[model samples]
Target chain A: MAGEVESIEKFLDEYMPSAELKEVKRLLYGKEIRLLEFPAEAEELAKEKDFELKGYGCDAARESSRLPKIVRIAGVQNKIVLPTSAPVAEQRDAIWAKISEIIRCAAICGVNILCLQEAWTMPFAFCTREKKPWAEFAESAERGPTTKFLQQLAQQYNMVIVSPILERDEDHGDILANTAVIISNTGDVMGKTCKNHIPRVGDFNESTYYMEGNTGHRVFQTQFGKIAVNICYGRHHPQNWMMYGVNGAEIVFNPSATVGALSEPLWPIEARNAAIANSYFVCGINRVGTETFPNEFTSGDGKPAHKDFGHFYGSSYVAAPDGSRTPGLSRTRDGIIIAEVDLNLCRQVKDHWGFRMTQRLDLYAEELADVNKPSWKPNIIN
Target chain B: MAGEVESIEKFLDEYMPSAELKEVKRLLYGKEIRLLEFPAEAEELAKEKDFELKGYGCDAARESSRLPKIVRIAGVQNKIVLPTSAPVAEQRDAIWAKISEIIRCAAICGVNILCLQEAWTMPFAFCTREKKPWAEFAESAERGPTTKFLQQLAQQYNMVIVSPILERDEDHGDILANTAVIISNTGDVMGKTCKNHIPRVGDFNESTYYMEGNTGHRVFQTQFGKIAVNICYGRHHPQNWMMYGVNGAEIVFNPSATVGALSEPLWPIEARNAAIANSYFVCGINRVGTETFPNEFTSGDGKPAHKDFGHFYGSSYVAAPDGSRTPGLSRTRDGIIIAEVDLNLCRQVKDHWGFRMTQRLDLYAEELADVNKPSWKPNIIN
Candidate 1:
């Protein structure tokens, strides 16, 4: 029996090999989100940049009344360009250069939108939990140098960019937030949504830095489609995904960072479940490579302190509303996954599945209210 | 990439083969749900009974404060015996006999709880859309012939049996429900929870015979542990699974009947996602084999009427609280899956993950209220 399985082969095997996947493109995902021909120069660009690049298509049966609104979205996963030994600005800038190559590739493939891994500009340093130079990485989301750089790339590429970062909220007492900033193709900082749930598990305790997001589920309506960002830990919460779908997001991106083995089993499950339940396109991007921090940190589990988080495992991919998905990128490498999806398929799936129509939200809302009472009791029958 | 994949190899590849899987038992899932030695005679019994029998174990570290509450749960997936051509009594009797062998096997294996596939005693004739003969399968939850038979078996085996069936409510104008009847090990009729979400997709639409359940998530307190049932279509609804978790269920059973390809991609994802999100053990049992109906029906998708609902694709398995799971049963065979779980792992995982602690129920309750309002707008940034 497959109990607590360890083989890397099993994780990669969840997705089909390229050749066989095409034959079953019509298996599900409402009207069959077909696999399109690979983008020209995809492998060449991947080989040149030393990063894995893969793409899939989510299509709809064109109706006479509704033109298929095809929107291409790209997700990138990469390690910190230079170690924490480098100056913060220089380190962030190195990532800027590394990510720029992927952004240009996304542009070459005509991506309408692109998303980066959580806190992409800096080393995932929350494991150290020290307050000095690490806090310096937090910046104002609106004016952050990372967001500004992405705005230029967005304008240069004529594409929307979602940049997840550690936001030092300037107006609100300068408290920090784990946030995703949305930059429009027109080079405007459209809006930002904070990461609602922060990790307290293992050494990934961001509560040492930021609290739960103050902002509710926020969906951004861009020229291409309606989208939302459920940062990192928020993917574990079904309601977080539910609210974004409730708000009519056609596509939801899970910009996440977690070590391998710790979460590899969960990686392929959650975002796909969200996509299936919410009837939306979902992109899951994770940070690649393990980084050795300048200082050692303890997980408080009686284990010796360590300097490095495990590999981030960069098997990012896209899932369509009909539950069909693209194969993940290499788990051991920096990579870019681009999926072109039709926004109309979201509504078509909702129409066919009738989940949104029959979701019984009122029943849950009433029960949740009852659960909140001080005298609340579980619905357990003895 | 893996877009709309069709090959059988891909799905089976998601699980590691036995020899390799045992190596990394502690990868995640808290303390790691280990694969224990197979029940004595498991292989021989499987061969003799002509069914697949597999088992895994979930263990926790020995603590000074509490003794381990080792509970063995079993899930069975099988087709209706003797066909609909036999009288309802004969059909039900044949099932009772076939299941008796498994019940005896569960007793030998010392299974604390056993759950059968959805509508196990019938031909899954909802696709026929006919009222006569099929409706005869609906029996009272408390006095249903199937439940009564299982009650006797439960007492005989000192086991709790979860029987999912077409329920004919005697007090409610003979209204039908897709329900799970919980019978205690001592032969008492404990309680029943109806299937909340009736699917409208494809030929699995139970709305043709029954409406959505009125009984909210009800967790039954058995001698072994607290358990609940999330019926077939309810697995598609995250809230349905969430409510069961909220009701303090230690183990949640999903007794489902779905055809291959229709939901093969989603089968391994949902229940496991629930177990991870809710910090509970989950058992997912799916009906095996295809059942051809007495008549043809159209899905209204412009295809000609069909007589069968494709393949049920039995791949029942158990998922532990920390996201590890047993390999699913053979997709083509009748089988039973047994997992020995220490319920304490649920709390240990919740402590380690803190998902339930940070779930923020009030926020969702408040937002869900707004969602119900006619003038409510999604928090969309244009």
Candidate 2:
């Protein structure tokens, strides 16, 4: 409205009182998980690296009895640096180079934990539905080169790093799975969780590559917070988000690689809704930019075949359990959003809202048992 | 940003392309169930009645074999015409008269199914916490004057009506429950569903009057569509919405009387999110204005005691399965939003989104069983 097209938040800010604006922000998101203003040195580095960086702080009302557990978390949304035709090693090395710099920037900004976009090490090639060269990109989750690369960065910066990658599970049968490996600040590789839900519509064609994640909703107990990852398409499933909260995650990162054409409308609402419904902080990190492939493809929508996956439209943002949210990052730029949130806010909002108290989990547990039954009938009163 | 503050939808419309604006509308609500344009006679009557009216239609893609089953549904939000000091019969008559006129208007507009706000016949008196006079409002769901009055109207117009009222169960120790009575088009007293999750937060204090709903997520299969009611505080629970969806509900009405200070932010998102997740139509109806009781009350918020319940901002609207929505009615006005929608869109969206197919019910069914256990531990990896 006043600034660049990306700055939609400024339009509301200019027209309304800060309180009312905060109300709307709170409706979509209330805990301001925005980009924190950097010191001059880091700003200079960001300028030099030609990447956008933003951050915010999610504060809790102070209590004399208990201290706040403020933890800094960062989400990086980015695009491929090199062409798909480039040698696989060079392409991965380019991403590694760019991410290493961003990780350094995160360290300077005091990010205690950071998560990269889904399959950050390679192109979003699931759309191709091809197996040969793309499957070659998959590597071991525990001892993969990507985890090895990030483990050093995690230890060096004393930061917890979540790396979503195409994992080659050699022990399981040389199968490939879309997975996120959590690297602790102590340079140890925590257990990994696979993408729970796979897309079958349009060009997502993820069913050809992997099935539903076998790992349950797993929360990694980190030095900063209890966190989990709802990878990519899993955001559409509210139950997936709910179980993670049930497992006592303080924060959940949605590392996704989705295009604007299929999911732009759902992008802003889903993660924010999950955060509000589950009473936890959520970081929605999406890959930016459209990548044109060497070959044409059809999305099965009866339209003409296309060469690209459409715009990823990166507008990564964060949501607090209180339903407060930060303004999203630039839709057209590679950027990272850093938010320092007090884990105490999670419990505080839960107490204030009483959502956990009122939510009748017993009701659903019984219903779901019947729901899974083959002879189940909906409770319809005709 | 454009005309009246009530028209927030206009701001986005004026600033962006129609398609992009449609995308935003699709996010919050896509099925544009809104008030249809009335005939000249109805318009004159609406003008004379001095009520705000708005409407829309939610369309579906054409299928060669199946015809579109467009059904109009209306939600009425209003203030109590007579103050609490007035005689109970006089107050009830005033509401009946006003609603009779609105129902007549709805009939003229060809509304197939209509739902009134929560506790529509009485002031939202749960804030007062005094039972002597307030409990007098509770009546039989089947034999109550409100049900009989609405039954005759429903039979006259051949339109189904949903009446949310405080129920007095004489057969069960005269207990009071928040219930919605479904009057079929044939004027038969269909089954009733009670408010599932009762509130204990702030001034709500609903638990003093009613326990959790005994009737589970019940869907009423009417001539129009299979629908359910998630009363007031139950909207705070995603599982409540999900269960109704599992019960094959095509539309879910959220009849609420929430105040601004406690729930204004959640008003817009919850029902809309339910629509998207559950692949159903959601009509979010809220009561308008503040009602001061004859006696003072404390909300237990550690604040000064007051006589009035805070304002019930009544920006009611409808959300479709595709995430499209109609613009809301005035926040501080007596109004009804009528929306014409095709129930087929629910299945269409489910087909497109693959949410039901990808949703791992078997997984949660197993997990929730453990979660319901007393000695269960979260899957937290240390």
Candidate 3:
């Protein structure tokens, strides 16, 4: 029996090559399986450019362009306990120190445009539905310490920084908004676009904190490329991605903080869809690790009280215009994923696919005009 | 040295289980890995219900609902040579016969809703750019021979059929449009939706044959469920999928005939995105095999002359609202993929995800209203 089993095992090994078996495991386990890694090239380029690259490939085809406008984009996913027991000021400082370290790492990696996870200044504590203390976390989008910290790094590295923050609009009677502040490479603040969509699922309770964004889809033309931030919940809205595309965004960054049980399956689908549907590049960033609050919270489902908001399985990835993607970052660790993207691919893909030329916007506008009307009805039988 | 290598190999094998190694290979190769298959359950149900079920697992969860609205949907991907040398009438007969054989197999599968590939009645000869002979493929949407043939099968099997056809609008000077004729289980005509987005890339030259569809995003109310058809190129449009969701479609069928090189990568992404974005089921179907035309066609890319329009690589699959999907059908051969879907999951997901309730359509409408005006800009710097 032992001999027979050994022979069967040998036959299996012969039938399925070890290399093929390893790839299958990567798919089944949904682990970080790198398709292309050019550590030697990155190391060489970093030394020449005086900027370190923690080692990632540059997917630029030489023959595809006469003058390629290539840019390295980095999305950082970090997780840390806010130390709610500490003073609010100390808590803020600790969070900033942690994120700045990550940003410093991104700078060493030679990222031209760096994006931090959504609302990086504070913990995702809105699930508690406690207002007074959480409201204290919101600050001025421009004058906030978070902005000041990112601005210093942006200017030092001469790189663009997209910092998603919970903004306290002081001029507008202290109304709060989820906003992404775009800082130019010159360390000057560009414009900011507030998150258009606010999630109301389970423990989100985002509507309690801020109303829908007043800012429409805004694209910022930075030194590296034309970019926009589709902050967190806005990723679910296809029209949000479309408007950015219509506005000529070459790359859109979706910085998010979602849990594993809530949206892990969808994390891989939407950004890639945006990249393909809009004929552009997408850098999807998510926060990592599990944060347990002081009090237990219910997910609104028929489940027992849970201490944490499920796992924030960070799988930050970059989706290219050609429907190719970088291997996602580790699900339970802090990391930055760097991808060298040629902005020209946006135009090439659009021309090759003709998605923009063929998209029927006029037809959609007419249909949308009826959405707010009382006489409007979807083709529903029930 | 050989003994040392063998010891190292044994250690590596022990470290990485053979089962995991096998899964990794499947991912790397992107093989047809079945995520769901339940032939025995389907066979048993078919015996009791007077219909046969081609063994495929259904995504419906029994405990999730008191009365689960579980419906088995089938998407048929077919490939048949048109025999252009023969009389066009004989060519039509041969194609219909081949498709009917596939449809009969679908009936055995106890599929509640069955969808055929896009423009399945004739060869995809639009590449030749010869309108004189290809226009002959167009027939009346309501009184078309394809609709008549499908009506017979739909009634006999008590299944709803979505048949995409090249329609000749007899009411308007015999104008042509890409349309999907919806046949009810009782053999009644359940209205039709036209293909809104038309591809004009390379040899597609679809604009030469038919104009863009004007039917709007119309969801057909069938006996089985509320469904809509996003014919071929229309799948590329996110708003096209959104409007259907706005109008309340539970399932959207994207019947496509695209070559492998042109869109094989996107084939898996878009429909799955639609399912996740809209919180609905997407049954994406595509035609298979390569058909060599009498004349060689250039794809306008300055490439060598090619007699075939690349391989279709049929990989029809169904994506559920929970972001899970069935393994796609064979890429090289014609086949049918069946999936059992619990329609109630759509509402469950919407409630959990809150994508619909949270989507700020009003904000988008305000932005889209500026699309035609000169004052509009998408935050572009250059």
Candidate 4:
């Protein structure tokens, strides 16, 4: 039996002939392998020889140049008074003041953006029968107080504001849309996107209050970068976020007002999922506190009933493209959470994960086009 | 104008005719709508009310059962003697004793399964000239001493052992296959899985050593459940894990002896990626210590050189399907980390995230088959 011996250089000469093995050799030579504690004599000898000892450890090569910029974001859970209240004007003023305070505090903390809960200025009024008079609160997007106030605040603090409201299109003669207004820092109304999908089941009587948003996925170019907003209930539909991403949204915001018993764990899941899938940053802003409105009138059937409202648990958070998160704001606390986000991290993640490079977008487009086909049904109640 | 007054009962009569409105009425009647507090008062109320809530800020439905059984897992980073080492029959007994001691200590900590680093019993002899004498270390799947000894200990302690070895088959003589031998608790040779993807890059001269794995992905059914082993470099491939999951592997083990500088961050990324993508538990084990061997000979160029062995970092860890990790076993510490894993959690995650439900497997199969087609390549890459 012959003993075949080969030095490290000989092995590299045979295996990596085309490459500059010297560079790799130079970088690794003489470094201590952190995982092992070598005998002092051996360590000293290795150091004397200038041989680099290598160990298993994390490399910061890809993460080196990327810097995360911290910005505060706030979500206000606004509760609107029922129509049966005596003075709607006075109630509206109080609600606006409360919302202003939230925006002001978020701006003071250097929040680049603040998102209000769904239908921020009003209660979920769609839960009741819609009378013609109830439409009074559904103001024009261009002329509404909510839009005007948010725009002014945007200019005041150099912040972008996303306000989901019952938008009345005056041009269409009182046609209402479930709309989200994006106000730019210069007090300009950049644009508005409507909810593409509306849930017809359960307590979400969204169709009764406003028509589905007509705008396709659109992101506004701001002083910071291109940003997009997906209103509450849209997160359940993954394509909504994807559409925003494909349209070049650097920062995507999901403004929501959901109760505590229904969706907390899913809270962390959604933003992370969106961030990873789209390779973009996701800000999940949830409203805190609770609201109780007065019952309209007595029951026709004489059954006992009382007014009830959702306790919006506030657990706002920001998820990076690689699915890492900064510590989120408390779900129970009514405060702002500021996180530094690096725009470069998106490119870094994309290069590393290669999801965008590997995504079959054309195939998805064809598949989604044929929505009538029967597919795998998961947790289908029907 | 007529003011239409409708009580909550009348509203429910018209809008929620199908709902058991009695439940909602019962929970809300005479109750103040205030924000819920820490211990999840809303959960208690909802449980009593017998109604399910679905939204943000809610706790997931608590499981009726207690926590699942915990098993500690440890990865042994072993250095194989390079093929150039002068064969010494007398050294086998000492080596066996040392390896046995490591396994015994791991078993004492309730480690049901211990995955030895790739080719645990022998050095990566392929680093130099290949000859028939190196085949002496190659072992048979059914009769290897490493397997025989580990099998005995497994039976004694009711443990399952995964031993990766340089394998030799007479029919295909000297064609090495980086393989993992699965030893069942009852001392049976369950089966073995060969490394699927072999890398030809870097210091990995795998092509010179072994043919690609003949067997595709495989999972072994042990007393503990179905387990699968992915060899060192195979961790870089995503489809490897996906195939294991489709074949019903509950726990996937990645046993590696990777050095630090070349690809360290990839260590944490690989295990967690497998766990998250496939919704299965992953145990990543690496060699924690360092090894140095005498240089047998010099290169033809006469540049003085020795066999430069790289240090293997030992940050072994166990990751849950939900992306939560028990603190990782330190790369510097020869220790164990144990955590109870609820197999049911996999189902829970799948149910909530709908990954499996939404996966169009047939389409993916077709796409992957032609992923490298010339037509599919972007012009820029070309």
Categorize the docking of model 3.
Answer: acceptable
- lDDT (Cα) of model 3: 0.76
Q: Pick by DockQ: which candidate is best?
A: 2
How displaced is residue B212 in candidate 1, in Å?
Answer: 1.0
C-alpha lDDT values of all predictions: 0.84, 0.86, 0.76, 0.57
* Model 3 chain A poorest ten-residue lDDT run: A1-10
Candidate 2 residue-wise lDDT, B1-382, digit = tens: 2322444554455555554554445544433344468887777778889888787888888888888988999999998999898887788899999999989988888899999999999999898889969888899998999999999999999999999999998889999999999999999999899999998888898899989998999899999999899999888788888899989999999999987777766677778888988899999999998898998889888989889998888889888888777788877788988998998899999999888888888898889989999989999999
Tens digit per residue, CA lDDT, model 4, B95-167: 5655666565555445677677677665554444444555577777778777888889889978888888878
How do the residues A1-382 of candidate 2 rate in per-residue lDDT, one tens digit apiece? 2322444554456554554555455544543454467878778878898888888887898988889998989899988999987888888999999999999999999999899999999889877888867887899999989999999999999999999999999999998899999999999998899999998878898899887889999999998989999999999888899999999999999999987667766677788888888999999999998888777888889999888988787889888787777788877788989998888988888888888888788888988999989999989999
- Which residue runs of candidate 2 sit more than 4 Å off their true CA positions? A1-7, A10-35, B1-7, B10-35
- Tens-place lDDT per residue, model 4, A71-104, is 4344444344334353655656666876676565
Give the candidate order by descending DockQ. Answer: 2, 1, 3, 4
Candidate 3 local lDDT, A11-49, one digit each (tens):
334554575444322222222323334446544543443
Ranking by TM-score: 2, 1, 3, 4
Candidate 3 stretches greater than 4 Å from native: A1-66, A81-84, A380-382, B1-66, B81-84
List fnat, each candidate. Answer: 0.68, 0.60, 0.52, 0.00
Question: Please, what is the TM-score per model?
Answer: 0.93, 0.96, 0.87, 0.52
Per-residue error (Å), model 4, residue B160? 3.6
Better of 1 and 4 by lDDT: 1
Q: Chain B TM-score of model 2, please?
A: 0.94
Model 4 lDDT, full chain set: 0.57
